[model samples]
Target: MLVTIVSLWAQKLFRLDEPQPFGGAELQLTLLAKALVKRFGVEVQFITRGQGPFEIFEVDGIRVYKLAYRDFPPARTILGSWDLLRLLLSLKTDIYVQRGGGIETGIVGMASRMKNKPFLFMTSHSWDVDGTHEKNRGWIYGTLYMTGLRRAAGIVTQIQNQHDLLWHNYGRESLVLPSAHEIPAPIPIKKEGVMWVSRCETWKCPHVFLRLAEALPDLRFTMVCPQANSRELFLEISQKAAALNNVTFLPGIPFEETEPLFATHRLFINTSEKEGYPNTFVQAFKWGTPVVSLHVDPDAILSTRELGVCANGDETALRNAVKQMYCDEGWWKKYSENARSYANATHNVQVIVEKFYSLLQSLKK
Candidate 1:
């Protein structure tokens, strides 16, 4: 008698809240889901919270399990941790990946250990690791956040600096894995002016973009301020943009719908205080649009690689960069090509996804 051996494919589950409106974390999750399904034929599941009834839905070829809740508290809180613990216990997943750092991640880490499963942590922002954010400033919160990070089987950081910080502060090993970018097919259209897209958060500093618009009176500036957790900030930015003739403010649209805006934009502006490899940067690069950033430069690639302009948090430098890009067409084209080339070579979804797959496979051993 002849016997045949059977092989099994791995099932990966991601935990986050509301996969819609695609913020950085959500975009990563969505891109990972697509890559895993298309490339590796892995069974991917996303667990999220929603206002609707508890249901499983398919969005863009991924299984999304939305837990019905009136309002989901931050996972670091007592109630939030308890809810996360209960939910995590109910599911049997081969590997659990969490994108944000908080009490919820700690609770999930604990649950993974108890269930004999591997938990992979992805640092979403600088505040997630540096302990500078308000949530991680206090000793109690810092301890709690670190507890989960420490429990993770492996940690993924977006930049080398973050990896070094993790090792120095938490004594944990991490892999520097930048977020993946899906290069959109080029559209044959005339792209013009400058575009800035972000949530209306104080830390994101939309006021800086508005000031840039003020400085460049002749250039058209389009601002997309998505309403997230801060309604007041959204209104403030909206009212301010209304006063400027060169500035136009748009309410948030679905993340899938923003490709055209990026494709047609001459440049992308980022005014965030800090980031863990911003999705916007990659998005801009994929569309052959250069980026003019205030502070974020993952690996100093902006300045060193000439992907775009990095102001190093200098207002004057940032203003000059924008003006230079606007006025000099040939210079702008060079940087734009550089942006696309760098993104295609380094942050392509296929390349990053393979890295992620290898990392997850290593955890199984």
Candidate 2:
């Protein structure tokens, strides 16, 4: 008699879909899901809440299931959890992953535990781990959020500092999983204007980019501001950009379009006061564009790897770095090359995705 062994396959589901007014977390989710399906043959699904009719759709090879909710926030979280729990049970998801810190994460965390399935939390921003975001600081809010974080079967952090912060503040251990980037194909570098892309939030400091554009009237500066939680700030920046001749403002486009956009620009500028291993920096490197950042460097890669100039949030230093990169072509070329080389070796999607897959498999045991 011959006996054959049957292999069991698992399906992973993300608790949220690519958010509207998309940001790094949404982009990361989309990329990771695509990589999982294309490279590893893993089945992936995204659960999204909407105010319209419930529907299911597919985008870039991932399944998206939409559930309708009536109200926002407090009620949404309560109702959304119920709907999500029902879907989780019916689909029998092997593992559930929450991409960011939110009240819903706690709800899902508890549901996963009750169902005896593994749940993982991935931190996308520094504030997610450190509780520095204003919303995370409230007593009741912090307690509820931390409860879910603590119950998670595993947590993933993009950098060592974030892992350290999680352990120090919440006593939660997390695996250090760096963000991945898709390197663009060989294309002629345009070497033109300075580019900035971010939400028009006060913390992001879009005004700093405007200031730099004013200082460097001879060089062209372009900014892409996407709609985010703060519309007033977005309008404020849009009005500010209108008054400057050297500066051009473009509405945010989809993530797929960002690589070519970055490739056309000679330099990338980051004026954000806080970050958690920004996806923008990784993309800038992959596009062969060097970064000039005000603050937030992960593991000192900017200085040690010679990827770009990191001023550690100093205004004068940021201005000087921009001037130097704008004026000196030879220096900019060297930094740009270093950026691509470093990103290729470190942020390659295949390598990072493989690491993520291993972590998922390990959690199964």
Candidate 3:
């Protein structure tokens, strides 16, 4: 049986150009698509935003078709629906999958219904399942996203909270699928410092991390903050980090190159106001680096499983957690071992991909 999966990922995320944007949702899409191809022999394709009217290429055995979503400015309005509809119908695939909450969600959902194909919508943020994401994006975009949400044949969320909220808000049932990852072989690391990796967005609170570094001047810290929303904000945060003698700041690092940092770090810190199971958390766990987070804790696994510490929005607690984890060798090793074991048992890419394949196959029936 041959199965084809088409994804509607953003071009900036899928492309390999210089200064390419790095996003957790996009990276998961890429990893899932590649695994589907390599492991299950699934034919994968992507329809993404592009500068040209049409551009075709391939990445890791998956085919990509670019559409000029940006060229048609009116497409931002309902008037541009037919152009996107046309592009999706042209794919002729078995099913469509997309992540995140945006106007594109509605576009993909509408196209799938028109062609009588199953469309799976995956939520990437807590806001994605809750009503806030829709309300923040405004009327037209939000309306389109709701349309896609309603029309989806299936929906997947990163955590149980999202699943419960999706049902409560929209009366939609979804599977709680943990984010997937390919585990690397265990390596010995010196594990000397704390590390933070995230796009420099206001909501992520990169500035809060700088404050943490300043407060704990005795400890070494590494901040890998790439430019997300504002270039000026990135520079501002970079300068603040540079002034801290204990902090080493890098504006960006490729997604493929981040594992070494995770492997070498004793602690991984997350300062985001909220999130849908951060990929960095999983990466840190895979590399046996304990996490100490300020706000977000997915599934409450950090506390229950002893994988890491969730500060529950306390800046002081967050700092203390980091300092304690970095200094107490025996405590750190216990959490590190638990983290690695938990990651392998729950997030192994091969097992998750098999689950997706089974779900996709059932949808076909």
| Winning model by lDDT | 3
Evaluate model 1: give its TM-score: 0.89
Please, what are the lDDT tens digits per residue for candidate 1 over residues 139-177?
656666677787888889988988988788778889989
TM-score for each prediction?
0.89, 0.89, 0.93
Cα deviation of 224 in candidate 2 (Å)? Answer: 0.6
Score each candidate by Cα lDDT.
Answer: 0.76, 0.76, 0.83
**Residues 1-365, model 2: lDDT tens digits:** 00000000001123333234556776676677778888887777776655466767776667777677545666665676677667766665677777777665666677677777777788988889877533546664566567668778899998899899999988889999878877767945567889999877788999999998988889999899976667788898899999999988986766666777788888899989888888899989988898999997787888888888899888899989989987898998999999989888888898998988887777753
Instruction: Please tell me which predicted candidate would have the highest TM-score against the true structure.
Output: 3
| Tens-place lDDT digits, model 3, residues 28-111 | 887888889999889888766555556788878888776654434565344446556777877677888888887778888888
Compared with the true structure, the alpha-carbon lDDT of candidate 3 equals 0.83
Which clashing pairs does model 1 show? Answer: 75-104, 76-103
Judged by whole-model lDDT over C-alpha atoms, candidate 2 comes out at 0.76
- Global fold similarity of model 2 (TM-score): 0.89
Give lDDT: candidate 1, residue 143: 69
